[model samples]
Target chain A: DAGITQSPRHKVTETGTPVTLRCHQTENHRYMYWYRQDPGHGLRLIHYSYGVKDTDKGEVSDGYSVSRSKTEDFLLTLESATSSQTSVYFCAISELNTEAFFGQGTRLTVV
Target chain B: QQQVKQSPQSLIVQKGGIPIINCAYENTAFDYFPWYQQFPGKGPALLIAIRPDVSEKKEGRFTISFNKSAKQFSLHIMDSQPGDSATYFCAATHAGKSTFGDGTTLTVKP
Candidate 1:
């Protein structure tokens, strides 16, 4: 197992509230990714960071923001949560373009 | 547009039977193809991977068959076991970015 961990394993928030999911890695990998998994959508990348302070948007980046201040920490923030945004979030770490190691996942629900 | 497409959303087989999962991609730039396996309540884990330069790669009971000209790849599980029942995902990567297939659920009856 990779040294990746996602905080707040389960969370529930009201619509319009703010939510932030944290992904921490101890492996000191170069790349980190945030993804959301839905029933039919599978896993869609929300954002990813190649290095500290270097971030990029992915397939479903709308309404979500991410920041990577250090090599080990990547943060995903939802400025304003919505019911449609409810999904299981996963964080991945990779040393290069090869295989990625995923976290356990965070199950978030917005009501 | 989905770059990778996986078929037979679900599959069932008896123990010891081989199960194959197919995936297709339209992007010719994709050079890395990998398969992931996920059990309920867990994140997807790397099962095996293959590159376009290779026709096939085998690891343990898992094999990745790639057809670069057809822009397709498939996963073959030999001597499938009941414990092998899980969701399988095929992914393609080019220029360091990757796209994942929806996933195929495999059920192996003992």
Candidate 2:
């Protein structure tokens, strides 16, 4: 509904392998966020970008990295996948500080 | 430290009944509060939101009651339908980043 799309809606990778999730938006929003949802933990922010080339870590940023080179694209990469990292990742976009709209989501599994 | 805390990890209610979810925050700096609803296999979507400046906000059957002094907020769904069965999350935002509660699953049975 927010013109947000996350590539590879579902993915499975073996432990120690590299995995990357991509979030694309058509809204040209200034704020983009990456959040992971797990049972009993709710949705935890992994990383977020305020603008192109401006990104910062979140509560659970360990072992994960993100980059936003353009306003419409934000990328999250798992340098080396781990079983504990398996979870549903959501991408959200917002203009300024208004409420954010989330993408369908990307379900990633590490075995 | 857990910034936001939500209660009643799960709930059940009959159709047409009102369901309330409560959340509390430790950070008084949080000014923006929002409630999100998520169905199975889908990402969470904004159901309703309230700013600290207001005591209550209503959007259709959904309402957000904010208590700044108590550092707490709650969401109430009026005449909840079976379709309203989903997981709900309460979030607090100080800036652009949001801190979320664990989530509450509501089951509305007909």
For all the candidates, what are their Cα RMSDs to the real structure? Answer: 0.7, 0.8
Q: What does candidate 1's lDDT look like per residue over A12-79, in tens digits?
A: 99999999999999999999999999987778999989899999999999999999999999999999
Candidate 1 regions with alpha-carbon error over 4 angstroms = none
Cα lDDT, model 1, residue A32 = 94
Q: For model 1, how does the per-residue alpha-carbon lDDT over B1-110 read when each residue is reduced to its tens digit?
A: 99999977999999999999999999998878989999999999999999899999999999999999899999999999999999999999876678999999999999
Q: In order, what lDDT does every prediction score? A: 0.93, 0.94
DockQ of candidate 2 compared with the true complex? 0.80
The docking quality of candidate 1, as DockQ, is: 0.77
- Output the number of the lDDT-best candidate: 2
TM-score for each of the candidates = 0.98, 0.98
Off by over 4 Å in 2: none
